[model samples]
Target: MRLVIAKCSVDYVGRLKAHLPLAVRLLLVKADGSVLVHSDGGSYKPLNWMSPPATLRIVSPDDVELEDGVISQWIVKSTKADEQLIINIYEELHESSHDLGVDPGLIKDGVEADLQRLLAEQIELLGVGFTLIRREYFTAIGPVDILARDSAGATVAIELKRRGDIDGVEQLTRYLELLNRDPLLAPVRGIFAAQQIKPQAKTLANDRGIECKTLDYDAMRGVDDSASRLF
Candidate 1:
């Protein structure tokens, strides 16, 4: 990774046009040819960025550019799309490169998968008499987060997310549609479970006759503590 703090102006052109006036900002260039322009604030989100599968070209300013006091110009062009980002650097405050070798990739801890596993162990949370059949129930599209049976012996196909958005609801709907096709699992119902569910997602799930569940992860973990000690 290469990091640069520079007095620069940025221009983006593609589906929409945007401009960042001259200021000292952070420029991150990743090994994958992705470039991110960031301000000091805004959490992890960048001010502007060109995703991977892009190319970066840096060159000294030309006569016209030099006349305007531009020292260097960097152009990042997307290979996958029609997007382009241009940065005109008048002065560089700092620059450094780090040789961090290949990453092992993210190891998530308390994400949706963990939530699904916890919910499967505590199936009764779904309702009294509820029992888990299995986790990652297989389907043609993908694995359903959890497959369980309700109190009345009805099949329940659940989709889990850390934050329930409309997309998560749509995913559960697809799984339910596919699962309902199987003769034995026919008439399968869906439950969209998450730690936090968006209002729009809840509305959509309710409209589709699918139940929305907000899980208390810490409470569920507390329930699991005793079980873990037994092993």
Candidate 2:
């Protein structure tokens, strides 16, 4: 990863046009050629970012830019889309590159898996008579969190996420596409269940005809506890 702290201004074009006035900020260039511009705050979310499969080109300031005191510029162009991010650097405060090796990916400490288990046992959370077929139901791409049949006996694939985002919707879409290809599950439907879902994700899921369910984690745990006591 390459990190730079500089006084810069940014302009983004494609789908929308946005401009950021001159400010001291952090610019991050990832190993995959992704770029993120971040302010001092805002947690981990970047103020502006371009995803991977992109190219970054550093260009010297032209005459006009030099006259305006611009020293350098970085142009990041997307390979997968018609998007571009241009950062005009006036002064560099710091710059460094770190050779961080391969990442091990995130370790889900059973929060989501536990939620899936509780939902599977209380399958009726989906509807009055929903029945669980299995948990960790295998598909060609990956194991779906849960698979069940709704009250109407229609196959339903449930994808559980702690915080639903657009990517989660996309993942569920792929699983549904694959699951529906089987003759027995030819008409499989999808339900995207999460503790909290973003509006954009909900809209996308709904547009794709996927049902969105907001899960109550505490309530689910309560149900699990009640069931355990009886057993």
Off by over 4 Å in 2: 62-67, 114-192, 195-231
TM-score of each: 0.55, 0.56
Per-residue lDDT tens digits of candidate 1, residues 23-77?
A: 9999999887778899999754568877656899887855344437789999899
Best by lDDT: 2
Mind giving the per-residue lDDT tens digits that candidate 2 earns over 98-207? 99998664445488978888898888998998999998886534578899998889999999999999999988987886566455675999999999999999999999
Q: Which ten residues in a row have the lowest lDDT in candidate 1?
A: 60-69
Where is model 1 more than 4 Å wrong at Cα? 62-67, 115-231
Over the full model, what C-alpha lDDT does candidate 2 score relative to the true structure? 0.85
Reference-based lDDT, each prediction:
0.83, 0.85
